[model samples]
Target: EPEVTQTPSHQVTQMGQEVILRCVPISNHLYFYWYRQILGQKVEFLVSFYNNEISEKSEIFDDQFSVERPDGSNFTLKIRSTKLEDSAMYFCASTNTRDRDTFGSGTRLTVV
Candidate 1:
């Protein structure tokens, strides 16, 4: 099965540095989402974008985070000002609908 894949599986960043996590979502899917898990915390939705515009976004997607679909297969999340609290597992997911979705292996962000 074709699944989403994220690069660097893990990343360590310094506070206030910029980080861009890459993802290749499933082809033929229309919806893309960014979700995060802060250590053992519950999965939190950050944002959802489709058709070249943001569809939905949670409060967690603040001024520091932005997402872009630079190509047909690539989706990227950029954090402009990483904070110590930003350390978490960032997962990229895609869905044709709520019933069908795939999640990437995830990039573990570590702020030091």
Candidate 2:
């Protein structure tokens, strides 16, 4: 089965640097999203993008987070300024419909 792939399963950065986490979403899907889970916290939606624009974004998706589909297959999330609070597992997901979403294993970001 095809799946979403994310690189650098784990990253440790200083508190204010920019970081770009990469993902390759499943082919033939129409919607894409970014979700994050702080340690021991529930998964929370960050943003969703489709048809080259944002469909929805949670409050957590402040100015710090941005999503882009740089090409047909690659989806990326860039954090403009990292913070200690940003330490979490960032998951990339896609769905043909809202009910069929699939998530990547996730990239763990740790800001020290």
Output the worst ten-in-a-row residue range by lDDT, candidate 1. Answer: 94-103
- TM-score for each model: 0.96, 0.97
**Candidate 2: tens digits of C-alpha lDDT, residues 4-97:** 8998799999999999999998898889999999999999999999998999999999999898998888999999889999999999999887
CA RMSD of all predictions: 0.8, 0.7
lDDT of 1 at 63: 90
Worst 10 residues of 2 by lDDT: 94-103
For candidate 1, write residues 1-112 as lDDT tens digits: 9899999799999999999999998988889999999999999999998887789999989899999998778999999989999999999999887676899999999999
Best candidate, lDDT? 2
- Candidate 1, superposed: residue stretches over 4 Å from native: none
Q: Give the per-residue Cα lDDT of candidate 1 at 55.
A: 94
